[model samples]
Target: MVFAMLSHAAIAQDQTVIEIQSPVLVIDQDRLFAETRLGSRAQADFEAHAQALAAENQRIEAELIAREQELTELRPNTAPEEFRAMADEFDARVERIRSEQDEKARLLNRSREEARQNFFGEVAEIISEIVRDKGAVVVIDRRDVFLSADRIDITEEAIALVNEKLE
Candidate 1:
């Protein structure tokens, strides 16, 4: 009888009380948005580069159009052999420009990938530091956690730590 009572008491003590709030994850969402917006220096650079590339492409297209018009106007007056040579030259130039544009696009993609890796590395480092400081065994997304007390909400603290590092 004593063993049965002791086992019952132990089981009761091990039970957890759960209280869930629908808006609990909102706190973490705000912190994440604020931190991401503040820390996205690479993102700004990427945008600027993208704009420049687009402008250059537009300019190249305009130039090609003008060149094609000039070639067409010159065609009716030229000897057949000379016209063929000029057309060949124009084709070669267009091909070269296409190749160069492909290379430029590849370079841009590589640079963006490198910037992404660097940004994520910094974020992970800041999060690890916050985890250590907060004595949290593991951190999960707020949406995944079923319930926890207000004391367990460390999202703002982690965001602050990330912002400090970003600055």
Candidate 2:
């Protein structure tokens, strides 16, 4: 009876020692955006629009400077009331143009953000497939994890898949 009890205890210990695989995984989301082709194209588009806006700003500034110079030249010869009215109109135009340009800048930023959000949405199915393949129950952003084994960092693998799967 004593021998049977000892043997049963040993078997229980062996069963308890069986390895349990980790269900969590990590991905570097920023790396996904920078490394994937989809992300690169989006970034390029945003940058191009931003550069165009900057050029437009410079052109508007040049035109305003020219207008101001013309107004200043006219001040000496023109009637005082007429010159003052022209100056006020110029100030009003400057304010209106400035407001419009600011709105464009804001819209550009908003579009970029929407593009980023759309990119992530496009990648969600890919991530889901990866999670299924890896038998991972949950995937957390790498930035959120305090410490994790490098083996669990799937950003590069995911990037390769994204590049292959996406245009």
Best by lDDT: 2
In model 2, what is the error at residue 95, expressed in angstroms? 1.2
lDDT of 1 by residue, 77-106 (tens): 999899999999999999999999889989
* Local distance difference test, each candidate: 0.70, 0.90
Model 1 earns a TM-score of 0.64
TM-score between candidate 2 and the true structure:
0.78
The residue pairs that clash in candidate 1, if any, are none
Per residue, candidate 2 scores C-alpha lDDT tens digits across 1-167 of 99999999998675443212347879999899988999989999999999999999999999999999999899999999999999999999999999999999999999999999999999999988888877788889999999987767779988999999996
Query: Which regions of candidate 2 deviate over 4 angstroms?
Result: 1-21
What is the alpha-carbon RMSD of candidate 1 to the true structure?
A: 7.8
Shift of residue 79 alpha carbon in model 2, Å: 2.6
* Residue 112 error, candidate 2, Å: 0.9
